[model samples]
Target: MNLGIVGQAVGLFAVTNIDDVVVLALFFAQGAGRRHAARNITVGQYVGFAAIVAVAVTAAFGATFLPERVVPYLGLLPLAIGVRAAVRVWRHRGRGGQEEDERTGPGGPRLLEVAAVTFANGGDNIGVYVPVFATAGIVGMSSYVVVFLALLALWIAAGRYFATRPVVARALSRWGHLLLPMVLIGIGVVILVDGGAFGL
Candidate 1:
């Protein structure tokens, strides 16, 4: 059961998107003052994710009702988020350095700011979670939470390590933005198919 749950969670995570990872990594690499900020972002993300999962599970168990068409609508969410993130990246291409500096100032990280940004970043994940829970049920919540937390920790650690490596960070930044939208599109497609939208 645990293995099944972990596998499903991993699949969900993989399909939801990785743009947040790239953004968090860049944020972490850009400055020292934002370490706490990154932590706050992670906290906010998990909180948001957990809330989404809870609601989804409740709906799955029939404790709360959701419209049958919700899954199809949810499928489009990831695509939208991906597009928005891609646009942000394109807009920041020339001014990436300026943007980083502004986000990570000399003053300690802003908790609310981090939370807000993180919440926004997790939007795609929320949409994906709804369909996942509606179909898979809550049998995997514990394992799903554990796996997500572990991945979050890994992402944070990787961000800290990459922040100190300017060359690697620069190289990653070049293509990272382009990948965000593609990842989200791919995930959205998968979810849509899973929901039988494509007759799968």
Candidate 2:
């Protein structure tokens, strides 16, 4: 458990997941301003991140081979999600349908919904993590995972803080429909370009 591994993990996670703060803020804004909502979001993020880590660790161990070429394609998951959100807002004028109502109501967010969004948001994370984990032996990987999980809590807290800020929350609530989709699509394009996935 080298301290260097821990530091690297923290830096890697923070850099790779900076956008997650915005995404989490959006999800938290959808909350009913209740603790349960925040709790669910936290749990969902954990579940999604755990899934990514599992796959990444497997790939690291040679149990799987998710080629670097596949990294950019993962962007499609978030792109589709963003398109759906945009369409929903357009059709309903931001008033949302029954499904939207359910999302914002007292019952709070469903675990699966949060998990799916979290997983989709982390599509790029897998690409960054696989190589890091592969390079790090088990001891290094273990340290990295520990630091990442700890930082994950900070992400949830930061999201909650943003949600509580009236200015940020209002802005997100008012414009998230348009902003979220654009952000998602932008992320996808970045991945494709950065990875040169198209070899263009």
Candidate 3:
């Protein structure tokens, strides 16, 4: 039992750094004012990712069946997400009125909306995560959760920082609309390759 715990901890720590970086990059690219919406996003990300990990772990235990072929197809998800993000960037680049409304109600962004956006942003991460959790065994969950929360806090802080700085904010806001699509596409290609879509 001790060995199992230690092994899980080590595996989690190993993966956490990479995962956190990816998460941070994704949220950062989404633009400023994300902090206000980030609370819900963080919670949703945690829950959604936790569920995926749980499922992956369970499937590893042979409690459920997911085909080997299907795993590779997971790459398509990120690819699609990337394409959509690129499109959004293109659309927003030309249109001034299409900016996301800042008028989220007192309750903030809707919980489901937050969850949906987080999940969408997280699509590429999921492709990376599902395989990692599957191989890392059952011990990685606690460490993964802790690292995820830590990264979330950092992401929120970074968002706030970028949103507040006038010069930096304006520059980022301008380029942000251009950058998001490229980032998404890059993530998608990476995911596709990782998933063995190109035959490893």
Top-scoring candidate (lDDT): 2
| Local accuracy of candidate 1 as per-residue lDDT tens digits, 64-104 | 55455554445565666667667866787788678667645
lDDT for each residue of candidate 3 in 1-200, tens digit (9 for 90 to 100): 35564565445534643443343334444534544455664565566555555555565565554455555555555456557667756665655754656423333333443344344435444445565656655666455545555555665566556544677556655665555456556655665676677686
**Model 1 score (lDDT):** 0.58
After superposition, the stretches of candidate 2 with alpha carbons farther than 4 Å from their true spots are 33-36, 94-110, 192-200
lDDT of 2 by residue, 1-200 (tens): 68777778889999988888987887777664444778888999899888888889998888866565776666666667667766766886745565455654464445766676677668668877888899888988988888989999999999889877889878876775567667766766665676676673
Candidate 3: residue pairs that collide: none
Roughly what TM-score does model 1 have, to 2 decimal places? Answer: 0.54
User: Least lDDT summed over 10 consecutive residues: which range in candidate 3?
Assistant: 102-111
Two-way lDDT contest, 1 vs 2, winner: 2
lDDT of 3 at 157: 63
Clash pairs (backbone) in predicted model 2:
none
As for TM-score, the candidate ahead, 1 or 2, is 2
Judging by TM-score against the true structure, name the best candidate: 2
| Per-prediction TM-score to the true structure, in the order listed | 0.54, 0.79, 0.60
Model 1 ranges off by over 4 Å = 33-35, 58-109, 169-200
